[model samples]
Target: MNADGDETPEAAYRLLHERAVGQSPTPGERSLSAAQYDSARADYLAEKRIVAKPGVAIWPPTSQTLMKRLGNGSWSTAMTSLGLTTNSGRTRGTGSFSDDDYRSAVAEFLDAAADGDNRSVTSDSFAQYIVWAKERTAAGAKRPSGAAVRQHFGSWEAAKTAAQA
Candidate 1:
């Protein structure tokens, strides 16, 4: 893990995994805190110099780079390999909501979007709808996120087509 560039990517991932081990956040706290990420970044920079800035993102490039170097696939796949759970709530595969419920939500959002001149249901629009619905809709109803919906249908286009059906 020296700065000599001798440490393998697998070793880097193993280091991150070790840091995350038994680090479950309490209620109201994020799964992975900024401090943890920064700490990892410090260690990462110490070992291999790069231009990754210190901040947050939907998917941090620092993590993505390390994951790619390890030959893992997506972020979720990399996290699974490291035995880490993402901060996102239950995914479609986890049974957070039924398929019908998700399709209904998309259909309703599309109907609203169609009322205006814009009929295109892009990922951005769906994400905004999720935020609006979460604030306005009654409690206890699961609102699928843009990522979740996209993952459910494999793409925004697929989701729109399924919702229309």
Candidate 2:
């Protein structure tokens, strides 16, 4: 029990985990995957971003702290060490993407659009590129979206210019 005495250790851990990941832990003996663990850590860090008090340091919790408090190892090693099962049944992308992937997808999309009847980038071209990029990406790999490309290059014309450059 904490100072408040109402929150049990399990409850406290659940609250933190839920806030960090936007969901509660899965029922039964299951552990998070490496990607999922990384995401949770990121969420925890994002949530912990607050103004520090005078003479008081506010540091985000680390994976080690979570491990110690949760009594479990990382998803990769937990299955062997703790005999826990993974909840991820199907392969899915982590949704974290790289700049290179975005740039490459944009280039590919522009090239395809040029080769097609439309020589210029339009909404249809962007949608086609998104489909092409998703098909080219491997299973469980993050795929680029039209919004991601726009965000990366500021606009479709800018993205086309960058690809040309």
Best by lDDT: 1
lDDT (10s digit) by residue, model 1, range 1-165: 534454554445445544565453333333343346547756655666555555733122355565564425345545545455556654425767679977998887777676665444443365666664574355665567767788889988788889999
RMSD of 1: 7.9
lDDT of 2 by residue, 22-100 (tens): 7766655565554565465566556666544687533333445445545454333343344446665543323466666
For each candidate in the order shown, give its overall lDDT on alpha carbons: 0.58, 0.56
The C-alpha TM-scores of every prediction are 0.52, 0.34
Error of 2 at 85 (Å): 27
In the predicted model 1, the residue pairs found to clash are none
Which residues of candidate 1, in runs, are more than 4 Å off? 14-39, 42-61, 66-92, 116-141
| lDDT computed for candidate 2 | 0.56
TM-score of decoy 1: 0.52
